[model samples]
Target: MTDSLTLRRPDDWHLHLRDGDMLRAVLPETARHFARAIIMPNLVPPVVTGADALAYQARILAALPDGMMFEPLMTLYLTEDTDPDDMRAAHASGLIKAVKLYPAGATTNSASGVRDFARVQPVLDAMAEIGLPLCLHGEVTDHDVDIFDREAVFIDKILDPLRRATPGLKVTMEHITTKDAVDYARAQDDSLGATITTHHLVINRNHILVGGIKPHYYCLPVAKREEHRLALVEAATSGEARFFLGTDSAPHSDDLKENACGCAGCFTATNTMSILAEVFEAAGALDKLEAFASLNGPAHYGLPVNQDTITLRRTPASYPEKIITGVGEVTVFDPGFPLNWSVLPSSV
Candidate 1:
């Protein structure tokens, strides 16, 4: 194995940098590690149009610390009422990079999501025409489907059909957490890709309930069984161009997380690179780190690879337990133990 690995500065193809004070607090963590991030649109009302996306992007820019070079690639939240003409204009204007699909009640702040696939065909057709990627939160919200089986069911019932319907559309299966997702993405041509979250690679469903309910481990597309985790590790380390890093490092306030109805997301941005490096190292595929972390994402998105480089070393590191947001402190997903790998900025 190489003693060190260097990669083009990675882009977080999927991320959630919430608005207002929360934005100010968490943007720096993501900015410190990623060159660019595809910001999620599931805010209070959601960013549904080009105008809202541009305004949101401005707020993100204003929140960034000076001299901290990080680009926030914005997206519009797809809803039944989303106007196809507006979406086409947004992509053409270069104000938006993607359109996120969150089936109603699929995850946090997604209550306004689309209820039926047929209702949003116009917007999807427009995206296909314009060459914009559709980022999906792939879970069927049917109450009868076992929570663990939601992803696989969605793959059969929604994603596959959607892809067949819009054959020309580019798609990124975001934070994919199942073996089916891995297989589906890999079977596709380069036009389709998948983003694997750091947490999903390292933790399984047991991590959430093993020792009482660990809210920090709770995330949408919630962690799956060990077999699925192994599948993700294999897909991520396979050096396949379809797999890339998209740390869905969503942060929720501790109160919101530890209460009766805990929120659905893990605050992993603070230690994502470290966790990723550890997983890749253990699999004896450290050599393939750069492609998963850097190259594949930009290539799929049709953007040039970043010129700068970042290094991951076999060094010990510790992350804070929580971040102080204006509403309240947010719990981070560190296991409260030192990590075996650490990411250090490098001048390339």
Candidate 2:
């Protein structure tokens, strides 16, 4: 058995590090392992302009703890009123890496998301022209559609037509949770890629309600059935450049998550590396872990791979179940199985 493995430090292609105290509490969890991350822009006001993105980036930097080295790859939250010229300036200045599309009412803090796809055509055209990528929440908010079917339905009703209409507009179907999504991504051209969350690969819908209501397992683009989880495992371990890691490590307070109307998110930043190692090793694809976690995301974004490296050793370990933040405790994602693979302390 391979006792230890080492590879380039990974970057989170999609992540949600909310602003203020929550941001400071959770940023270290990701920074401890990941060299950089594509920071989500769904803050209360949302980062909608180049100025908004720049200000948010400065806050993230200011929140970083002493001696920690990390980079925040900023993104703009696409709204119906999003100014294409502002987007162009952000991209030209290299402050923003992509534009996030959250269908109206699709996910947390997405009230400002686009409802009319036609209204955003000019922005989409500009993005395609400039070679900028669009990150999608990838679910429809139609009241008639079953929650489980939203993802597939959105692909057919929205994503397919949009891609066809805006040729060469790079799209990232973020936190994909279904076999249909996997198949769609496989069928699409190189301009289309998808991000698989660390939590989705480990849990299924049953994990949330099989025995009792497990709120922490809940997240936007919620986990699907075992069959879908298996497909995510297959695709993630297949070394397909179009599929990569994006932890989507959203953090919500314990009080909020435990309430009757809890928010959607899983705080997986704490143990994502360890859990990812376990998942890859189970599929006997340890050799391909680097490609999925580190190489592919940067390639898809037209960026360089991280130079630092992290090592994982085959040693059983347990992580805390909750993280204490100023607001309240945040529950950590439980992989259910004891992790035999653990990331060693950083060496680079």
TM-scores for all candidates: the values are 0.97, 0.99
What lDDT does model 1 reach?
0.90
Error of 1 at 121 (Å): 0.8
- Candidate 2, poorest ten consecutive residues by summed lDDT: 339-348
Clashing pairs in 2: none
Tens digits of per-residue lDDT for model 1, 187-300: 888889999998888889898998799888899898999999999999999999999999899988988889888998888888888888888888988888889989999999
For each candidate, how many residue pairs have backbone atoms clashing (under 3 Å)? 0, 0
The 10-residue segment of model 1 with minimum total lDDT is: 334-343
Candidate 1, residue 204: lDDT: 93
True lDDT of residue 146, candidate 2: 92
TM-score between candidate 2 and the true structure: 0.99
